[model samples]
Target: MKRRSNLLTIGMLALLVYFLLPLFWLVVASTKSTGDLFSSFGLWFTADFHLFQNIGQVFTYGDGVYGRWLLNTLFYSVVSAGGAAFLCALGGYGFAKFRFRGNSTLFGVVLAAVMVPTTALAIPTYLLFSKIDLVNTPWAIILPSLVSPFGLYLMRIYAQDAIDDSMIEAGRIDGASEMGIFFKIVLRSLAPGIVTVLLFTLVATWNNYFLPLIMLNDPELYPITVGLAAWSSQTAGGGGSTGDLLALVVTGSMLSIVPLIAAFLLLQRYWQSGLSAGGVKG
Candidate 1:
């Protein structure tokens, strides 16, 4: 038993290092000047530290275009994640508690959708949005992100066990309207599930690249993912100024992940509880 435990411990430590090594490298690389990036060892910092300078360049480049991209990301992620979570909670609650025609069939369709990759739907979604003249607009990103089949499925499973039929019945007995019951009672109960879904959608939208690339041609409207990619492409092309842009890209990449890390840290408890509850119920 002790031998087995030691092996497991060693395995877990290796996995941890594997996951964190790149992040460690990113932190180390961000502190180096672009020239030192290639000259110095990747895993360690050099004599000169340029993290602050790189960050300033990231924001000041192209007249603070990176700041615009950062704001766009925040807007898109927050709006889309919040809307998707709410819609998922509503749809999930309906599927879980209400009896309706085609309930099973519709839910099965949603389950099937969960298996379908969002990338596959991107072109079709873009075509549909083009017909509606939403192409190149923020809606092109926000609207599509608001629909999460997986979040709906998660909320359905969570709501099934998170909410009790008797509490809903009691609310209805008191003449609470459907919307009132949802907002006043059901939503409160769905907090953990909602936060879980919110975090999922938030990260997805924040990291989204291809969709925004296809949807928006305007650089000002780009998210951090797309914006950093643009900078990376510039670096790839190789010029006298490539080193500067490369440093900006690395620093920007590090800065972009900060919010996601903060979000996971802040919501870790709720996320864990939601997963635990879902696991138990499943």
Candidate 2:
């Protein structure tokens, strides 16, 4: 038993370091100058402490471009996540509760789409959107963000266990319309599932780099991920005077992840409760 406890402690420590190592490096890098980044050790702080200055430079660079990118990220993540959650709830509830023509086939298609990654569809999506003039627009991101096969699957599973057919029948017997029952009764019970889907969609949309890279050419339209990547690229040889901008890039990257962290913390309880409850029910 003592040996097993030691092994468990070691395992937990290893997992902790594995998760926190990158974040630790990121925090250390954000406070460094470009020269210090190259000369000093990767994990430790250098003699020069430039965190605040680097943060200022990040926002001020390119005439406050990082701020615009941050706002763009906020907008995209919030709208996309909310819309995705709503759609997921509607679809999941329908699939879980209602019997319709081709329902299984349609759900199966969604599951199949889940197997095909979004990255694989990027170029094709870009071409399709380009033809429709949706390229370089927020719609390019927003429209695609609304469709989450995984979110739908999660909600469908949760709705099944969370809401019993007896409950639906009870509502219907009370002369409630299907939509009315959904809004009043179903919404209250599906809270955890909705939060789970919202958090998933929020993170996915927040950190999306590849999709926006192809969809948007305008810097104003670029989300934080794409904007920071563009900055990071400038430090390469022959990439221009961006060698001095490395600190800003690192700091900007750090800043960009703050909202995501806050979001996870805020929604974490709901996420855990919902997932664990769903797991037990399943």
Candidate 3:
């Protein structure tokens, strides 16, 4: 048993290192100057620490365009995630509790949609949006992001167990309207599941790259992911200022992940409970 425990510990340590190594490297690299990046070992800091300078350059470059991308990302992610979570909760709750015509068929369709890749739908979605004259707008990104088949599925599974039919019936007995019951009673019961879907959609929309890249032609509409990729492409194209741009990209990359990390840390308990409860119920 002691030997098995030792092996488990080693395995856990290895997994920790595997996940955190890149983040560690990013922190180290972000502190180094462009020249120090290449000259010094990647995992360690050097004499020249330009962390703040690199961050300043990241914001000030191209007349503070990175800050604009940051704001765009925040808007797209928050709006999309919040909307998607609410919609998913509504759909999932209905599917879980209500009896309607063609209910099984519609639920099956949602299940099928969960299997379809978003990348496969991107071009078709773009074309549809173009016809509606919504292309190259924030809606181009936000509208598409609001549809999350996986999140719907997750919420459905969670709602099945998290909410009780008797409780809902009791709310109705108390003269609560459908929407009122959902807002006051059902929502409180589904808090963990809602949070789980919110975090999933939030992260997906935050790191989204290809959809925005293909949909938005305006740089002002670019998210941090695409803006950083653009800077990376410039660095690869080989200019005399490539080094400075490279450092800015590194620092920006590190800064971009901070919000995601904080989100995970803050909502981890709810996320864990949601997943575990859903798994057990499913």
Best by TM-score: 1
Identify the candidate with maximal lDDT: 1
Model 2: worst 10 consecutive residues (lDDT sum): 234-243
Clashing pairs in 2: none
Q: Compute the lDDT of residue 30 as modeled in candidate 1.
A: 93
lDDT of 2: 0.91
Question: Tens digit of lDDT per residue, candidate 2, span 1-282?
Answer: 999999999999999999999999999999999889999999999889989989988888899999999999999999999999999999999999999999999999999999999999999999999999999999999999999999999999989889978889999999999999999999877988999899999999998999999999999999999998887777765355676788888889888889989988988888678678778867
lDDT of each: 0.93, 0.91, 0.92
TM-score of each: 0.95, 0.93, 0.93
lDDT of 1 by residue, 45-149 (tens): 887989999988889998999999999999999999999999999999999999999999999999999999988998999999999999999999999999999
* Residue pairs in candidate 1 whose N, alpha carbon or C atoms collide under 3 angstroms: none
Ranking by lDDT: 1, 3, 2
For each predicted model, how many residue pairs clash, with residues at least 3 apart or on different chains?
A: 0, 0, 0
